[model samples]
Target: MQRKLAAIIAGDVVGYSRLMAEDEAQTYSELRAALREIVEPAVQRHGGRTFKYTGDGFLTAFGSVNAALEAAIDIQRGFGTCPLDLRLGLNLGDVIEEDGDIFGDGVNVANRLQAMAEPGTIYASASVVRSADKEHVARFRRIGRRQAKNIPEAIEVYAMHPDKAAPNGLARLLPARRLSWSRPRPTVLASICAGILVTGFIAAGSWTERAAAPPAAGSTSGSLRATAADSRPTVAVLPFDDLSAEPSQTYFADGLTEDVIANLARNRELMVIARNSTFALGDQPADIREIGERLGAQYVVEGSARRAGDQLRVVAQLIDARSGTHLWSHSYDQRIEDVFAVQADLTARIVSSLVSYVRQSEAAAAVARPTADLRAYDLVLRARGHHKHGGADRAALLEARDLYGRAVELDPRYATARAYLGLTYISEQFGWPTADAAELVARGLAEAREAIRLEPDLPLAYQVLSFGLAASGEYEGSMRAAQRAVELNGSDPDSLMALAKAQLRFGAYDEAVENAERARRLHPLAPEYYAYIHGQALYAAGRLEEADEVLAECTLRAPQDPDCLKIRAAVLVGLERPDEARAAMTELLRREPDFSLAGEEVGRRFGNSPLMRRFLSDLSRAEAPPSAA
Candidate 1:
């Protein structure tokens, strides 16, 4: 085998195998037609020789990198009315010619890049784009880099957006993307119910949505582009194995897993991956490296739980996913009553091992007893589990609310349980069409404030208060409470998220971005609202391009989320993509026909900032029903 400089092209039919399985003869015919009528000719015209065909894909190489890319673009553009969608990858590197066959990292890298590309999209390595002609470079829009399968280092990737060619396409120097999180914005209704006077005061006219100077600190990188060193040491707690003989004990195991995640999440020093992402892995036996790469976690915590009679046995281990080294291991054989203590011990050990600057206050607060009543604690854990079970199901929310209320009833002094109860109430109210939006907010706010009154220092209480105050349209007050929570425990993603949301409202775009980024780094699998808030901040700051990217992802992650759709539509409007924005608005209206941002409630919620005024104007221009714009 002799190595020589070459330009590699990898092309594959999107969902070709699935298409073939459905209609073998028709798929085969279409595939052959594409290869014979379009693909082969394009390669030949570019002076590229087709080396091999692997069912749905083919490998080609050319002397000129620009020619290979031009071939890829032409082949993609060739599919005008054709139903078949193709993904192409181009890379410039040295390849090994072996016995009339081409092989090497160049070919592999091209394939990996192709696999990462969207259907009907062309992705190229940085080397390919840099070596190609200026004309070719002008067509590229750097989406971001990626950690491709089996690739030792991250590959800088660029997408060919020939359809949206602009004078300056994706030329902005952007930060690298990393895995972050997001959720939809909850509807905030101003309480005006007679006989129910709201006592909270909003610090109005104190803040404006003016673009602040960008801070020298904080990374602007997308979650997909962020490196591990850019943030904290992230960890994912995989679902614990159920070793119990009784089938009903599954809840206990799930509760234990959630408890561990919750306790670990309290220490802001460690970035704990959300349970949703970890639970999605299911029971499959995956490589540590794969888990790390997928979850962007440096460490993974896994264990098995069993209950025999009145005794409980749990074995847990923490491993470094990068090196596949066991960092710590522990086995506990304790009564069911000691489960909480065991969870605390495990969390403390993991934090101490992974982080060097665990504040003494946080460490002490981390293991602080929520309640001595084991039954109440168990109820709270089960309630939390129900709440965390995927989307906000009304039944689940009700069940969790009832359970949390019972937990608090059983242990009157349980501040954590009370705080969670309030949150569960808020979850129950989120988008509930039947309830009085204002009344629900009032109830949730009352519970949250009571939680704070019960235990003033409880971070969870303050976290809920942040949400409550924001729901009450007290953005400044909400931000202060959120900041207090962060100061108390800087590792809590919820606190950071709350702070970011408040900052966004008060028009502190840069600070909002910084906090949102930190929150996302903490829980890379954060709620869809996290992404929404970050995008809002970017949009308010006039960074329409970056905001478009974040909002696009938010919509993809949660298609039915109205907030994501609204922001995505707004971002599209900001970018002057009217048709796309209209399509997004159509989807939003279809989902939420009553969607209107110009309502009095919305106006009061989003204060009167120039950016808010602009957003309202944009929404109105997009045909969103205007209340009083």
Candidate 2:
């Protein structure tokens, strides 16, 4: 046996035993695939070798501590939306290697640390943290000292901050991959600990208080809004199948289905069928096309849920009911401490996925439909296609505004159309040169209020009102409106995004970043504006690298968007990349020839705040257009 200093990594699947119990062959195959595709590849990439496989876990050795920690981080991120959850631990100490396997206190300490880690997180010994590079060390926070099983002395541990693990360059810009893995069950202690942590993270500040309040007074009673001849695509969410070993778990499945239906109804874009209408068909499986024809739905959302001990597995799919084509599908496996918590999260994820797929499918269909057949809802849908592309396309923005106006004229009671019409005015106020800013702001505010009057529970109306208020310099009112939108529908990405933007304008940078991140998490396939807002929040909070990464994604998605280009240029300047910043500024100037540093537009948006100063300084450094100051 040779003793030498090495960085050791220990990783274990969180619920390996439960996975095997459910399906031994499939579990074994998935474990092998994970090791081969994710774990081993990451290890190799970071100059590590998997020295041993501990059945449901693995032990890896790296010559460098930084490499070991990086490898562990990469492996954890690689799991992404996959059902598998891994706990990783790293230690730097003397190890005994014999016959290509490691042993001794180093390996033992790593195993103990791995056992202590929460699911999808990394824990490292103080020695490892000390040996790591400064950049890597900064990403971890001390977790105090802990006594390891069979170890003589207490060891100091550090946990990596979840948000600090930045994706390399534009990697995070890509759509999340949908991968399947056998579900694992967490230990009782781990489950309770994770539950507490999740609760604390989610229930921070006033948001939880607002979330606990009852729905707004004028909320509808969960009925389908669209009629039989409604131009918008109609969606039906069927009751989820109970795939558990015991039939008693059907309640959980049914509750999840109901929650998903309710959440989808909050989105004004789609006409969601009421739970009663879909659940009336019973739990029997039917052909997608036949179900669509019977229910008069263009799309169908179907899924199954399984409960095993304290763990739950949910598999969902979005289908084009007309063609019986599966548009998207994903599976979620989570440890359940509170059934309602699991239901809420599962519902949000499912609804977000369904909305993205449905919108894409609808937009494609709308493009093919002739203009003569367009109705208020159809016009709004087509308008959204233009609106989401940002204000760089002058013709498109004008077209979207016109379409929204026509939509409102056709159906004055359509709160969704009016809200979007208000949003267009606000967008125009910021994006274009306007002679009567007060009139634009007034019109925007009026439309938003009218929409709210028409439908008080409509989160979109509240979101539009928040934007309009912000543009009118009513920060307090803007915040209240944004908060109300979130309180009404916390799962809606648009609501979260509106709140984030309001928070940013209100000088709550950290809160802005948190809300924007939450929005991105909910809607992985969200439009470019999501990235723009998230990057803006990060930039405001002085997180330059993260802001740079996110803004890069925003520019890639909408290359001509002036807001994205402006922010990207500022971030590049902050990062001290003068040439890149100059390049970005050149592109920005190409898009907006009248851009200027001392323009009233900047003051109108940012006021005299520190963020505005920083934004100006960065732009000035990038050599933006000359100011008339």
Candidate 3:
């Protein structure tokens, strides 16, 4: 049979080996199913033919590039739930009746292009894209050009999203690493707590009402419209993996990781993952797609770190997390103090390479707020400064508050801390301070005000305001604060999640469920927030079965958690399982009797929240309950 000119398409899993090692059967089953469901029918619709499955991936050919691009879009739209994502590359070339398979530079180009395309995306060289006539084809947005092995000069490249096959709505996601504020030495945390005292509760002059306008902030709306990377090639620095013999060295490696995060955070073109989220991946291998989805990242920077003697070596690799392949890898050798400088050098190199590879006007728009006053390390230090103080110690929070205050003081524009400090003030009222209700409310508002004034764009700041307002009995005011936070960072799983939880405090059940679903989709492994939001929402809505399942998942994720155990008691009672409910309450009382008292007090704000009401009622009626006695 004579063969005509065909557009060749090639794509394979980027880190199949790593994925397999972690989960073999699950990965293969999903991949095969995706191919059958999404891949085959897609190219067939485009007048294309799919041969056999190559070992790890597959090969396909189309008569026209337009058909191929359309086929790619169909596949993405068809299969979005699979664990592993695909990367596709297409080229125009010829194939002959040689062996049972196909050959030529077109196939080779597509194969190599697969290596270049971001995961869950399609990429094509100019040679291939130009072949598709505009009338016959969809959209195409050029992301960059690449120098092919045998081709002369660089090949222009365009990327097409699955749904936006025509290429008019191209967007990006980012994955990144954050440094933990923990120390190798536990006692050191105690000293930090002791040094920092209760300035967390200074009173704010006023609190906004429900109808008051939201503060002017950067972007947190979660909408792709204001991604801030408009023309600039955006990137993400993923969390670093620890590879040390001693587990304690995890902190040291984490410290270096923060160094990288800080080094890159300074580059406005790049989007660094917040530390709170990054540390969530400690020692756990993550699917690249999952990472990209969670952080809303376009690129993922990852590496491992180890410390030997006075010398340290950190190995880092940049991955198109969307694709899950090792794009570039290098090692850094440095002394402890010099480690910070090495991160700066690496960032400059990676960014320069992106500039060279990309033809976009720039990497990202002028989106980063300025932070000139505080040394970046202090930010990292504060995160650890508070958490390291084991449990409900006031000293640690005080230190954290001071560090956060100084951070905002030094850089009035440092929005991240402004959000965190607001949370601190609200947390202080959780019995962490001796302040009365009026004192606590005033102080929490003040901290929230300062935070928003510094970073009006910070979703977390808005979230804190929600928490503060709700606790102080400003029901409607808290609701607006939660909504504003959502608008600021709708794309951020954490932000969406916090807003959802806060909405529960205001009796907004529908909005709460919607945000929780969004948050769960973006970051499926969110340990704390995911469980709390949906479980509480379901409980509030009287969906006892759904609430039970959600709480069960929370227990599976964190079996030892007292809060998870306690929350389940209310669900059990709703299901007419009082004995089970008593068991759950018994577990809760064992951990902290005072929890019951707070639950009782908090129940008034959240009507129909069975968990809080029962926990409070159970404790109040029980002779053995410590809080009542």
Candidate 4:
């Protein structure tokens, strides 16, 4: 019997049973060929040995974590063009080798991670990531803490996509450099690398510090920059040119651009630039490479929309920004009434080209039509335009609300319109001083529920419902709905932000910070509210400095936003900067004269939880105003 620490990899073929059932002989042959041609050579080249081969998968061991990861990545890349879909999981831990078989918690953990991984991807334990080479570390993105079946403690998981393009434009399947290897040593060095797994992973604070560090210079600010390490393809959609006979149809073109961006953003496999950032480029023509560099995007979507009377003609193209190649293009000519169908088709085709494997369910959800009534759809689009430009302007919000109301009346089955209408009411409660708060909350909740009833799968409806529930003091229900929204549309920034907000109110600060950070990454040009939510979560989690920095950005972005001011004051108080805290409170009071710690409104919103009590205590220390009553 022998015991030592080593890096272990567990792999399995996705849909192995179905493949074999369909063609047993062919499936067996392909599996054997993949093992012989791809897996064994990659393992041996990286100084690893394949210890065991299951009928449908294999287990490999390496003396070093780096070697194991390289082998796994190579194997996955090799299978990219093959019929088989492979998922790999890596772990660095102590294992027992007896009679040419390895056994222990280490092997169990690797198998669990393999099972959790998505098809054709790798999931590694935190210990594996921590021990990996810094260069290889860049290839990993933390998915979050996941509890594997029968695992005593949750394991923090990081994922890597093997098929993603390399930064140097070379294929990922390039042969790995051979490593000089002698006998595997069981020594202090191996123990040090395996220490984290023994200790049940690093503290949450440590993980956050690592993740929240500022991005390197020359990378895209506020975004998950697409580098050689992070291979998720980044895309930008510029505002479509309006070639309409009447210039008044420009809004239609802009609406099409926004819809395409929104749909593409829903696919987690691709990073879609926010509408604001891309649209800011306007209708200007420039070098595709330059636009890509500016947006940190590898692909660009450009199009033109022409509307003549009842006939609509739209032309769209997808360009490979790096090589200036037009990968795909399509022209659509349809009645004005079929514009929605055209938008759906355009979005689906773009997604098909960008993602290697597009889940039909997610693609369908992304292009789901809001309403069959053209008038209702047009009204909702106009309302969104007003909302986007309005910010906290009372007149603008009222105008949007009126338009959304008309849309709902025109097509009562329009879930998206009802959801947005509910959002406006909730916005009124926070930003409109003269608005009836209780009435708005009731109306918002009712509208949100109706939207959900109309379309249960609409992520936007669940997000709105979460806000309305939170406002109405249904904290648990609010959290549940927010979770459902994320589950339904994992890549939607709004859904993620809402979940973060709900998590914040429940004192799940770590999760709140994570989700909020994800939302910011997905939509780098996200509104000031994202900052507010993220900052508050950091503050609640006792990360005062990070909270202060994020809140400062929020204040700088929207100087007049009282929510930002309120959180900034709390963070400053925590940092022991009493004068700055008081200054923030003063500014907050200037903007919201009725702001008070002792008010029923504050109590209703924050409740009497320990976290909220601390928040109120901090506000009091900052000399915030007392209730008028």
- In candidate 1, which residue ranges exceed 4 Å CA deviation? 1-232, 355-365, 433-435, 598-605, 627-629
**C-alpha root-mean-square deviation, each candidate:** 22.6, 20.4, 20.0, 12.6
lDDT of 3 by residue, 572-595 (tens): 876877777777777666765566
Better of 2 and 4 by TM-score: 4
Q: How accurate is candidate 2 locally (lDDT)?
A: 0.70
Per-residue CA lDDT of candidate 2, range 41-152, in tens? 7888788999999999999999999888878877877654345667888899999999988899999999999987767678899898778888887676544456667999
lDDT of 1 by residue, 28-144 (tens): 877787787667877887799999999998999999998887777767766432457677888888899987789999999999989876655688898987798888776665433
Best by lDDT: 4
Q: Which stretches of candidate 2 lie over 4 Å from their true place?
A: 1-411, 555-561, 600-605
Candidate achieving the largest TM-score: 4
Which has the better lDDT: candidate 1, or candidate 2?
1
Clashing pairs in 4: none
lDDT for residue 426 in candidate 4, whole number 0-100: 84
Off by over 4 Å in 4: 1-230, 283-287, 359-366, 433-436, 600-607
Give the higher-lDDT candidate: 2 or 3: 2
Which of candidates 1 and 3 reaches a greater lDDT? Answer: 1
* lDDT values, one for every candidate: 0.70, 0.70, 0.58, 0.75
